[model samples]
Target: MKKGSLLFVFILLLSSIAASIGFAQEIGKDKLFVAALGDSITFGYNLQEDKTKPSSQAFPYLINEGNAEVANISFPGWTSSQLLGALSNQETLLALQQADVITLNIGSNDYLQAIGLQELIENQTPIEFTPELQQKIAAASAQLSQNLQNILQTIRQNNQTAPVVFYNMYNPFGASEDPFLLSLHQAGEQITLTVNQQVLNPIAAASGSLLVDTYSAFSGNQAAFIIPGDIHPNAAGHQVLGALADQALASLVPAAPTVEIVFSTTEKTEGPVKVTVTADQDVLEMKWLPGEQTADKFSAAGNVINGNTFDVPENGTYTVYVKTQEQLEAVKTFKIENIVSKEEEEPPAEEEPPVEEPPAEEPPAQEEPPKEEEPAEEQPVTEQPQEETPVNETEKEERTSVKEESTTPVVTVKKNELPDTATAAYNYTAAGAVMIMIGAGTMLFRRRRARVN
Candidate 1:
C-alpha cells in the first residue's frame, strides 16, 4: 500500500511539470494575434455574399494565410464616429487587449457621406461635390480628425504594447474615364490626400502607431487593385495590403513565407478558353465564377465553374479561384469578348441540305407538264357560260328597249286623261248607233205591213 501511494504521487508530480512546460511554451510562442478593425475595406465587401462576416480573402486572412489567430471586427458602412463609439464595448476592448497587431482604416465613410456615396453607388450617377459641399466636407474632416484621434487613444489605452497599423484612404474612382465623375474623382483625391497628410500622419506619429501609405501604393493603379464597380480592394489588392501590414509587424513577429501563384489563359481570347494555374505550393482545388469575385472557404458561393478549362456560351468577365495545400487562396480575372456559338458553327451544314436538295427536287415538279392539263380541267367553265349566253342576250335586248319605250310619251298620254276620254266617247257613239238601228227596224216593219194591206 505504501509503494502504491508513492507511485501515484510520482505520476502527479510529472503531470504537473508537463502542464507548467506547456503553459510556458504557449506564452512564448511567436505567432501573432492580429485584430482587424475598420470599415468595408477591412471587412472585405463584395468579396463574398454575406456582408456580416469577413471574407477569406480579406487582408487579415491573407496576412498569415490562416497561420496566426485573427479576429476581424470590421463592418461595412461604418464611419469613424461609429468606430469610436464601438471602442467602449466590452467585447471590443477584450479583443484589443489580446491583440499583438491591430490594423485600422476608417474615416472614408465620413467623407463619402457628404457626396451622397450610397446614392451614387446604387444609382451610378456622378457626385456633384459642389463648392458648398466641398466646404461642408472640409468642415466634417476636422470632426473626423478628432474622432480618429479619440479612437486611437481608446485603442492605446486598451492595448499599450501592440503596434497599431493605420491605413489611409485610396481614391478607387479616380481612374474612371467618365466626364461627370471627373469632379468627384478630383474632390475625393484631394480630400484623401489632405486627410492622409494632415490628419492620419500626425495622429499616427503622436500615438506611436505605424502609418501605412495605402494612397501612394494605389495611386494610378486602382484598376488593378480595386473591384470593377465597387470601392473595395480585390483579392490581389488585399494580398498586397496584407503584405504591407505584415512588413510593418516584422520586427515583433517574423513575416510569413510568400506563396507564388501564376495564372494564365489560352491564346484565343474568346471561344473555348483554357485557364492554367501554376504555383510553388501544391494546388488543392479551384473554382471558377463569372465576373470578378474572390474565393471563400472551400470555394463557396458558386459563381464560376469547377474546372481549369471553360467553353461557356457567353462573353464577359470570368474569375478563377485557386487554393493550395497550405490553405492559401488566389484569384485571377480574364475578359472574354467574343464567344462563337455552336449554332453559328453548324450553319453551313444546315444550309447544305436546303441549298442542294431544293433545286434537285423542284426541277422534277417543274417539268411534270401537269400545269398544261390544268387548263383542260377548266373547259367545263367555258361550256357552262355558253349555255347561259342566249338567255343573257334576250335580257339585254329587253333592257335596251326599256329606255326608248319610256321616252316615247305614248304611255304618258295614256297615263294622263286622253286615253280614258277617247274610250268613253267611242262607247257612247256605239250605243247611239245601236239605238237608231233599233228604231229604224221598227219603222221599216210598220211600213211593210201598210203596203201589204
Candidate 2:
C-alpha cells in the first residue's frame, strides 16, 4: 500500500474509536430514578400524583431529567425516628438502594409531635409538673437527632457513591405573636436547627453529602404557599420545594460524562440492580462495578460492553459502585440475603376426624286447665241539679266603655305634655316680653323726671 493510503486508514480507525467512546458516555442521559424519603411534605401531600413528576418542577425535575431515578417512600405522619426505622427495615433499604438520588424531608413530624406532647403537659390537671414528661421530651429530641444521624449512616453504608440530599425542615407555624404558638414553633425550630447544624451538616461535610435548605425557602412566603389550616404546602409549595431539590441535585451532580449500563440475570435477585445506562457525553469506555459477591460472576451480551452481575451473597449488607468513561462514579447497595424465597418452605398436610351421632327428640309436655272468665263490672252514675246563670251584656259593655274612656284620657295627657323644643321656645318668649316691659317702664319714668325738672 502507498504511504498516503496507509495514513488515511489510520485516521479512519482513530475516528471510529472516538465515536464509540462518545456513544458509551451518553448512556443514561435525561433519565433519573429518585427515592424521595420523608413525611407528608416529601410525599407531596395534596399535590397531584402527576404533578410530582420530575419534569413538572425546575429543581427535582432537572435532576430527574439528568438520567436520575426517584422512588418516593414518604409516609404522611412519619417522624425522623420513624423514617430511620423504615429505612433500616430490610425491604425499605433494598428498595431505596436502587435510587441514583435519595432526598429526605423528615424531622417536622418529630418536632410537631413533641410540641403536641408539650401542649398535653401544659393542659394537664392539678397544674402539676412531671419530671417524667420533661425527660420524655428531651429524650425524644435527642433520639430524633440520633435517628437522623443513623439514617444518613445507613444510606452511606448501603450506597456511598449516591448523593444523599437532606432537606431541612421549613417553619410549619407562621409568624404569630401568640405565646403558645410561638413557644411551640420555637421548640420545633430549635430541634430543626440543631439537626441541620449538628447532625445533617456534619454528615454532609464529612462524607460529601448534599444539604438542601427548605427552611429559608418557605419562611418568607408562608401565608401564600403553605396550605390553609395545615403545615404542608399546597401545589405552589411543592413547586418551590421541587425547585430547591432540582438545584441541590444539580450542584451535587454536575454535567459530566454518563453511560447507561444494564444487567441481565437468569432470575431477579433482591436487587439494587442496574436496568439501563444511556450516555450523555463523550467518553473513552464503560464498565459495571459489581458488589463483592456478584463480582466476576456474570458477563455482558449484545451491544452491552463490559457488563457484570452478582448474587446478593449475604443477608446483612452490601454496596456496589459504577464507574463511567469520564471517571464519573455512582454507587448503590442492596440487602439481598434478607429476601425470603416463598418456594423453599413446604405446606402442612390436611387432617380428618370422626363425626358424632345426633340425639333423639323429647316428648311434648301436658296442657294446663283453662281459668274461669270474670264478669264485667258496671260504673256508678250520679246526677246533680244544674244552677241557672244570668247574662250581663250591660256590665260587659260598661267595662269596655270604661277602658276606652281611660285610653282617651291617656292620649290627651300625652298630647298636652310639652316637647323639649316647645319648652325652650316658651322660655325665650317670656324672657323677651319681660325685657320689653322693663325698657318701657324705665323710659316712661325718665320722661316724667325730665318734665318735672
| Winner by lDDT | 1
Please estimate how well model 2 matches the true structure, expressed as its whole-model Cα lDDT.
Answer: 0.56
Which ten residues in a row are the worst by lDDT in model 1?
380-389
Model 2 agreement with the true structure over 277-375: per-residue lDDT tens digits? 446654434333334433223233112234344433334444444445565654443444434344665687666676776877787855453343343
| Model 1 lDDT per residue over 1-453, tens place | 356434543543343333233323333455668888898898898888887788888888776444657788778999988888888889989998887677888988888886677777668676665788778788778888778767766665676566777788888765557765675577668778887888778766555566788988888888899898777899889988988886665544322223333334434444555445444556676666788876663345653434444454467787667666645567777777555555544444444444444444444423232222222232221111111112365654554444433332331322333322223334444456566667778789999999999
Model 1, position 328, has a per-residue lDDT of 56
Model 2: how far residue 269 lies from native, Å: 68
Q: What's each prediction's clash count?
A: 4, 29
Estimate every model's Cα lDDT from 0 to 1.
0.67, 0.56
Model 2 Cα shift for residue 135 (angstroms): 4.9
- Error (Å) of candidate 1 at residue 258 is 26
